[model samples]
Target chain A: DAGITQSPRHKVTETGTPVTLRCHQTENHRYMYWYRQDPGHGLRLIHYSYGVKDTDKGEVSDGYSVSRSKTEDFLLTLESATSSQTSVYFCAISELNTEAFFGQGTRLTVV
Target chain B: QQQVKQSPQSLIVQKGGIPIINCAYENTAFDYFPWYQQFPGKGPALLIAIRPDVSEKKEGRFTISFNKSAKQFSLHIMDSQPGDSATYFCAATHAGKSTFGDGTTLTVKP
Candidate 1:
């Protein structure tokens, strides 16, 4: 509904392998966020970008990295996948500080 | 430290009944509060939101009651339908980043 799309809606990778999730938006929003949802933990922010080339870590940023080179694209990469990292990742976009709209989501599994 | 805390990890209610979810925050700096609803296999979507400046906000059957002094907020769904069965999350935002509660699953049975 927010013109947000996350590539590879579902993915499975073996432990120690590299995995990357991509979030694309058509809204040209200034704020983009990456959040992971797990049972009993709710949705935890992994990383977020305020603008192109401006990104910062979140509560659970360990072992994960993100980059936003353009306003419409934000990328999250798992340098080396781990079983504990398996979870549903959501991408959200917002203009300024208004409420954010989330993408369908990307379900990633590490075995 | 857990910034936001939500209660009643799960709930059940009959159709047409009102369901309330409560959340509390430790950070008084949080000014923006929002409630999100998520169905199975889908990402969470904004159901309703309230700013600290207001005591209550209503959007259709959904309402957000904010208590700044108590550092707490709650969401109430009026005449909840079976379709309203989903997981709900309460979030607090100080800036652009949001801190979320664990989530509450509501089951509305007909």
Candidate 2:
């Protein structure tokens, strides 16, 4: 409902392969975040963008990278996929530090 | 280390029963606390939120009780229905950054 869309709702890749997920938003929010959800880890932040070309790493940033060239698009890339990286990834948008609206989610599996 | 800790990894209750989830945090800098609900195959959505300045905040049948001194907060669903069965997460925010609890899976039987 927040006008957020994540491309490649589901993906399966082999280990050592490259994978990238995209997040697009229409709310013109300044804050965009990428998170991964696992069985016991809950939602762990992967990366976040505060503005165009302004991004920061999160708690679980290892082996992952993110880039935001525009206000509406945020990208997360797995340089080399690993079995441990298999999880549901979520994209969220927020006007500020307040309430964040999340996308449906992207389920990725690495074998 | 986990910034926020949530209890009761899973719960089950009969329809029309009250279900409560508790969370504790060690960071006093956290000023905002929010609860999120997620159904199977869906992303988590905001259910309710509260600030440290307030002792309690309610939205419809959902309530957030906060105690700044105790560094804890809890979510209560009154007369919960089967539709309310879902995984719940509690999060703390500070300086635009947020830390979330592991999550609690709630099952409401009719």
Chain A TM-score, each candidate: 0.98, 0.98
* Model 2 agreement with the true structure over B23-96: per-residue lDDT tens digits: 99999999889999999998889999998999999999999999999999999999999999999999998877
Model 1 Cα lDDT, one tens digit per residue, A7-98: 88999999999999999999988999999999999999999999999999999999999999998999999999999999999999987557
RMSD of each: 0.8, 0.8
Worst 10 residues of 2 chain B by lDDT: B91-100
All candidates' TM-scores?
A: 0.98, 0.98
DockQ, each predicted model: 0.80, 0.79
TM-score of predicted structure 1: 0.98
Cα misplacement distance, residue A35 of candidate 2 (Å): 0.5
Expressed as tens digits, the lDDT of each residue in A4-71 for candidate 2 is 99999999999999999999999999999999999988999999989999999999999999999999
